[model samples]
Target: MTISCPTCKKPSAPRAENKAFPFCSERCRLIDLGDWLSESYRVPVGPDATERDGVSEDEAAGRVRTPDDLPN
Candidate 1:
């Protein structure tokens, strides 16, 4: 099967010896890696504003109000 490189748009032959399977060459592979490291690619967390550790914004906001809320 023949595959085209996403970066260079070059046609590449499919073979077990091809280290850069999808990419045509090492340069294209490295470019893709650089994009990942530079934050060009983003994986969405979610719509909620809460922290990943389960700390909600409202809970954090409530911690600072009123002397009665403080522990002895």
Candidate 2:
């Protein structure tokens, strides 16, 4: 199946044939990585981690959370 490169939105090589399957070339792939390292790209987060998973920010970071932090 024909696919488009995520970085440049151009035609990309097939996964079986291309090392950089999602990108047209290594240049485009590195460009995408640079964007990530520079924080130019980000994934949107929703809701607090504590409310969602019952794991508080402290717990998530490997610290102890106080028992007094009640969920609303």
Candidate 3:
């Protein structure tokens, strides 16, 4: 049987013993994983939506300004 790597699209021999199935090598698998971990691939989200910790978007956007806002 034959299998092609999903990343490089290289032809690889299908081996039941091989741990890296669907990928030809560890490098290709790691590269694919790095793309995900480093956000080279992204899931689309709607605009005007942001992640906030407890604070409403308006409140977060309109935070108080003070002289302390300036770095010493």
Candidate 4:
């Protein structure tokens, strides 16, 4: 199926030959990585998130920030 690359928005089909499948190229893939490293990207917490669930936003964010949880 044809899909647009997430980083470049270039339309292409996902193929095993492309190491960066969701992105247009390695350049676009690296640009996305840099954005995340610089904190230009952030996972938005849902509006319904609350302490009532016994998990505050800060605590959940901390859990995700661990190096072990980071993509290789």
Candidate 5:
């Protein structure tokens, strides 16, 4: 059985033998990771998630989103 590489559209068979699995090579896998890192791909989320993400993003960037977040 054979499968197609998600990155390059190449045939990749024998999943157990291919360390890259869904991708054809380490290069393809890294390329896919880069795409995700660059925001080339986005995952769908709900309104609740988006709201939570805003707070999390601010905190991750060492920001204080609200007055209550200020250090005492």
Candidate 6:
């Protein structure tokens, strides 16, 4: 069977021996990795999807105001 590299879309035969299965080569694999690390690629988050560990964005940013921390 034939498959295409997810990064460069190059068609090639897939084999278990291929180190970069979905990708054509190590270069293509690295490119795909760079995209993920750089936030160029993102998994879809639904409205119902919650943050991991239940930490809201405000809490994560330390924006939750406390009485003692309130402005005078």
Best by TM-score: 2
Order of candidate numbers by TM-score, starting with the best: 2, 5, 6, 4, 1, 3
In model 6, state the lDDT of residue 23.
87
Candidate that scores best on lDDT: 2
User: What tens digits encode model 4's per-residue C-alpha lDDT throughout 1-72?
Assistant: 887888778975567868787787777777777777887543334676444455565677767666787689
Per-residue lDDT tens digits of candidate 6, residues 21-72? 7888887787778778887543334565455545766566786566898677
For each candidate, what TM-score against the reference? 0.46, 0.51, 0.45, 0.47, 0.49, 0.48
lDDT of 5 by residue, 1-72 (tens): 678888788997566888998788777777777777887453333454466777788888885477887797
Better lDDT candidate (5, 6): 5
Cα lDDT listed for each candidate: 0.69, 0.74, 0.68, 0.69, 0.73, 0.72
Per-residue CA lDDT of candidate 2, range 1-72, in tens? Answer: 779998889999988888998899887887788777887543323453235454455467875576677685
Q: Please give the lDDT score at residue 13 for candidate 5.
A: 54
lDDT, candidate 3, residue 40?
A: 50
Give the winner by TM-score: 4 or 5. Answer: 5
lDDT of 1 by residue, 12-52 (tens): 65757668868887777777776778865533335853354
Q: Candidate 4, after superposition: displacement of residue 60 in Å? A: 44
* Model 1: pairs clashing at backbone N, Cα or C within 3 Å: none
lDDT-wise, the better of 4 and 6 is 6
TM-score of 6: 0.48
Between prediction 1 and prediction 5, the one with superior TM-score is 5
Show the lowest summed lDDT stretch of 10 residues, model 5.
40-49
RMSD list, candidates in order: 10.1, 9.8, 10.7, 14.8, 9.3, 9.4
Error of 4 at 21 (Å): 0.9
Better of 2 and 6 by TM-score: 2
| Location of the lowest summed lDDT over 10 successive residues in candidate 6 | 40-49
